[model samples]
Target: MAIVKMEKMHLLALKSEQSKLMQTLQKTGIVEVIDITGDKKEEEKQGHKEDRIRDEIAKELAELETKLNNLKLGIDFLKPYSKSPNPLIYGKPDVKKDELSKILSNETKIAESLQRVFDLDKKIAQLKSEESKILNQIDFLIPWQGLDIPLEQLGNTDRTAFVAVVIPRKSKDKLEEKAKESQLPLDIKVIGEKRDDLYALIVYHRGYNEDIQSLFKEFSVTIQDFMGLKGTPNDIIEQSKRRLSDIQKEREDIKTQAQGMNQDLFNFEVLYDYYMVEKDRKTNTLKLFDTDKSFYLQAWLPKERKSYITDTISKITDMVYVEFTEPEENDDIPVLLSNSKLVEPFEVITELYSLPDPRGIDPNPYMAPFYWLFFGMMLSDAGYGIILSLFTAVALLKFKLEGSGRKFVSMFFLCGISTIIWGAIFGGWFGDLIKIKPLWINPLDNPMSVLILSFILGIIQIFTGIILNGYKNIRAGNTADAIMDQGLWLVLLTGLLMFAIQPLAGIAKYVALFGAIGLILTQGRAQKNPIMKLASGVMSLYSVTGYLSDLLSYSRLLALGLTTGVIATVINTMAKTVGGSAIGFVVMILILLGGHVFNILINILGAYVHSSRLQYIEFFSKFYDSGGRAFDPLRIKTTYVKLEDL
Candidate 1:
């Protein structure tokens, strides 16, 4: 597997054929048009009026975008009242091109329906707001129900002034005694008493209004007034209740109308996709160079698709000129990965790091095996594996997932299979529940073996990366640099590893010595000063520490594997300890189910994160060249409905 080969394409066509050619290209969805008019000198030489054409296309695109946005807003407003489909069911509704055309032709009718729904929603919201205000007023007036006088008339009298006030229950007696001691002409009547305050109505002649105000200030009484209210408390309460009922009924009627407009939602979706397709088509046209009566375009196409594209263009028009040539050596070509189906899912990981350089090799196939092994080793449990595999399998089967979604689910499915294999080898079926004999040593019993295995795997991956780097160098005709930079280290590192083991120490020392001498001689060959060259070569030996650190990092695999088993065993023991009675058994079942599910989720996340970390930081550091741009082809971009081929 490698990066797909691409050819640079140049096309010239008459203005009459430009629209037909663009439409065909968009439908084919394989050509990534590039603008050729870069500098003012080139634009003047070509005499192309791209700016005006671009402005026209941009205006059309903007209008389409506005229409699409309005349709989306309408859909969101009606969604609450409409019948929602099952969320787990994925994939856009398939609509034929003719059907989409029909929907577009009825755009005015659709817009009217959306406007109607929007107006109804606005009215319903206003009614609900009014209803809420009335309900709050009803609550506030509940304690004042006993008052028989109109609220407005309480404080409005030519001869006498009236006020409703609430005084703290504890201070009411003292205030009344003080008022009597002053021989005030205030006529006070207790209206209502809540837990903390006594509501009272006070009436006085207009001449004593000042005295009544001063008495209220001394007692810290709060005067209550309902501004602009003309009816008694009970009368207003009945009117508010009736108004709330009417508003609620109006809202229900609006909701019913919205429910009946569900068919409009489907129509809106089709139109949204149609407009999106048109918008993208118009946007792509901006990339073309246009003259007064002709247009020219450049693109990069897959080498294999050149024939198909040529045939399609020939069918469109015979007046167009198309030429394809190999990309220049210095061309910054976009990269598209080519891989077998089994290796494809791992491309997601590669893309996350960054796509491989167009000239560089695809790393997905190389990285897939290591990623699979690492994930399974970190989350080693057969039961958890079974659950993960089954879940992803169902999702893959039930939904028509595309692009990154399909790759993500498929990658996890493969990881689950690996987990099952490792779990079976370790004899871990839900933390010792099955008690089957292990094909390999149990990590819990002999963790040192597992740790050694992890280190061995790490060493293999790191060395594999170095070897791949060497291969790349060889292909680039830099064999000496490859040998000096990577081959010497491969030998030296292998010797160091062998020397660490007691059995190979006698043979390994000499091998390491030879590698060291070779590195000293060749690692700093470019330095002219002899002493500086030797010093540089000596300093280069320090990179062994980086390799050592990378190898030690794999110890996490053993650590995580042990943690999963221990937590699972603890869950099992806790469940069994409380499972002696009937009720206890039910509790135990719940604990067993929920506890294991939680454990699986946490460990799975850890596995994915750490596994990706190793790939990104440790393994890919050896040979990957990032920063390649992705291939973006002209195509129909839809939101709600999937359009059939035109």
Candidate 2:
């Protein structure tokens, strides 16, 4: 399987049939409408009229989108307390198209329901704020409750000023003695004594205020005032407590009312899906050309589906004209990959790098086997593999995950199986819990062997990349260039590899020498001057060092595999060290479970990152023709509901 072929399509329809035609195409969800209006000059030349009907449709769609967003916000706010039958269930409630129309027509009622929830939220916030203020005031007034005078009457008299002060408790008697000695017209009344301070009220003639302030300042005194408060401190405190109780009750009532509207969440979901479809239909029309009585549209669709699309459009209306043509060689055709189900999950990895150019080969099928093997080798734990597989299996079966989400989980599920296989081969059954011997040597016992295996696999992947590049060149009718660029290097590397082995050294030396001479003579064939060509060929031979480095990059696979086993074994050893008394055994169980789980999580992450790095940096850098645009079909993008086929 490779990139799916695409064909350009042009359609002409009467203005009256435009809406029906667009609806049909959107429902089919296979075509990608090309933006003909992107070029200002081309748009000016065409001079297409802006249809008022489309403008009105756009306005309506915008309003609908806003309404949907508001409704969703309200639904999300209430969801935690909604008490659904099964919160883990993923599918949205189904509703017919006509029922959706009916719901939309009653937009006023839905808006009112959403507004009610919003109003309650706002009121609850205000009530909470008020409650906090009241509680703080009560705490503050509790310290001043012993004063018998009303706070507002503290300075009511024109001739007298009243002030509250806190002085060190030990100095209360001294302050009284000093006040009497000063002979100021002031009344000193000690209200209360806290741990380290005495609360007092001082009433003095207005004229003696400055003198009294000076006297108090001489002995460190903090002035406390409850300004703008009416009635006695105790009365005010009681009143605030009552108000706080009322606010709490009101807040609870508002919460109950908001929770009661949770059933409307389903309605909101339906409307959200409805607006999404409507928005897509309106937005797609912007790419169309419109006249007073007709509309012209252009799009791209899969070539294999041309007949099906034609038949579907014909069924919609015979008045519309459709034409399909092959895309040109130089055209920027969108890429849509086609692969067997087994290989499809790895497309997630390829897509993250870049889509293959329409003219280039799809790399997913080529990279899948290697990626799976690398992931397994890095993780290399049978127990972790079983856990990972089960976790993903439950998620896949329990949820309706789609698109990238579904592919990602499926990829991990497959990787888990690969991990299990590698684990069994390497004798990693939960870090030697099972006494079964390894089919292959354990990395801990013989790390050099594992490292050698990593390099060997790396060499194979590199060779595969080179072979694929050569194949691509051959298909493009550049056999000479392909041989010089890929084939010569392949031969040279193979010869060198053979020469490294003791048995083939004698024959391999001559083979490598022959390949080296061929590369030196032919690598710069396109150059004009002999000296420059030969110099360039000599420089090209230096890339052998790069190839060697790429081979060494795979050593991380062995490193990670060993790291996982060593950490797991450490966890087991720690668990065993603590196993003595009953309490010690229980502690050992806790430590073993938590430590192993944490180790598994950390190792799995390391395995995924390192494995992906090898593929992306070492493998894909070879021959991937990136920068192709992804195929984005005109389709319904639902947020809450999946639309069933009509």
Candidate 3:
């Protein structure tokens, strides 16, 4: 329910045992390594030049990173062919320590498999490129297949020249008439017509080539080239088609081969994770400094794990020296939150906003109940609640969701329970479908009551925030600030609220006057000029409107709650109106199911967003001081496999 306490750690160990020490600390997963190698000023201040000594592991780390990348590429290539386990059912596959070692022992085989996959990918790429060119050649040949002369024979002779041209059909007659007028020793044979073009083979005497070319150019004819092609169009087309069939067969064979390597996919995954862990270990070494005989390291660890970490390091080497000290007031300490399992899920809410200050309180325990209440109130539908609860319950039990994933689902599960309670209270069981009597007042019949209840709830939350702020101020020994600022505001707000009650109306005015006078005196006490101070104090009273606005924001609770009920009722009414005949009844059932599903999805999103908005805007504004960095410790980080002890 609070930020975990941390302590600074300085360690000295033999240079030879540095690797062992790092491995031990990494397995403990409790230390955040820091680089002291570049702290020249600190080293000079301490008069310990030994701290400046640093080791270079960049080359080794880079090599390991390259290996990891290759392994990742191989795994991705094989994923589609592999029988991957469903994350919903199996989560991440776990690799035992012994199993990891066994997999690594066969590293030679895995490397060969990876190389094979790479080669196959390269070969397939080349084959596809070749297939594209062949298909284009076939397209060109298909339009000229009627020509009988071989392509090589269409080049030239000493006395005669051969050429192929395609000219627009509208200009064919004109070109022929022009050729006749020129009387050039040329003959044009129309091989075939395709679309708007006429494909023709033209033979002309070499001496009259220029004249024939001029005649052809009059029609905007396009000359065709089949350079170095030896066979006729039909023969070439047949050969290219056969080659295409072969390319297809070869591609299929390559795919089959790649699929056969699916069993080795896990091996690739394990090796990738192995390299990744090694890379992390090596990368952290950059934060360390080493001498000829010894090495120096600095880190921060949780106070609670001090004994455990020290003991683990002691077992690794007896020549090691370790010291721990309290963090300085100005130290930029990383924050790690600790909370009970029941309250843990709501930490996601705070994190989504921002991490709380290390010196401040964890807001999860305080904000969870209000968020749960608000979310349920907004979504208030018993049927939807039951469905949400059951679905999330199954997901939580079946899937090994980790980190924020698990927290979000668990939060929703709890919200579902709250929704069910509120729905039952309001007598809303799927919008009057079950005919259940009201356990409380229905918002539709008397919205004013629900509206009042929402404002009251909002007031309670706002007051709670102010109280927490006062507590924080008191903890920091600013008792006067707490009372003058927070205490007086609470007094004024509470007194003003009391004036609405019949029994307390007589005393409420006096209480309100005292609170207002106190605020007017204290709010601007820091102002030096008398006139300015009085004016500032008077103006401070105007902020009551902000609090009033905050209270009004709770109107959304009633609005959303009523919206859900009204929409559900509309869906039911529309269904009944059409459910008179057999076909209509079928459509009615579909409409009910689909409409409710859509309604649930849309409203759930709304409830989450609006509920979170209230907390961030109205509640947290009073006390939360954010902007703390998260704690990151050195541990085995694997993507495909969760490492476990055998």
What lDDT score belongs to each candidate, Candidate 1 first? 0.86, 0.84, 0.88
- Summed backbone clashes in each candidate are 0, 0, 0
Evaluate model 1: give its lDDT: 0.86
Models ranked on lDDT: 3, 1, 2
lDDT of 2 by residue, 1-646 (tens): 8899999999999989998888889988899998876654654543434646657767887887787678777777677667654523656555676777777787788878788778877887788788888888987787688998888877637888888888888777787788889888877787877789888888888888788888788878778867688998899998998898888788777767766866576677677777778778888887887777888898999999999999999998989899998998777799999899889988898888788888888988889999999999999988889888999999989987777888899999999999999999999988876666888888999999999899999999999999998988999999988898998888899999997699999889888888898999998788999998999888889999999999999999999999889998988888889999999999999988898899889998998788889988888888888888999888877766656542
Model 2: pairs clashing at backbone N, Cα or C within 3 Å:
none
Model 2 ranges off by over 4 Å: 40-54, 85-88, 135-149, 156-160, 165-205, 212-227, 231-238, 644-646
Q: What is the lDDT of residue 501 in candidate 2?
A: 94
Using all chains and alpha carbons, the TM-scores for the candidates as numbered come to 0.92, 0.90, 0.87
- Scored by TM-score, the top model is 1
Better of 2 and 3 by TM-score: 2
lDDT, candidate 3, at 488: 93
**Which residue pairs in model 3 clash with each other?**
none
In candidate 3, what are the lDDT values of residues 273-384, reduced to their tens digit? 7788888888888787666687789898999999989899999889999999999998888999999987899899999999999888788888988999999999998888
Q: Which runs of model 1 end up more than 4 angstroms from their true locations?
A: 40-52, 84-90, 135-148, 156-160, 165-208, 211-222, 233-238, 329-332, 525-528
* Ranking 1 against 3 by TM-score, winner: 1
Clashes of 3: 0
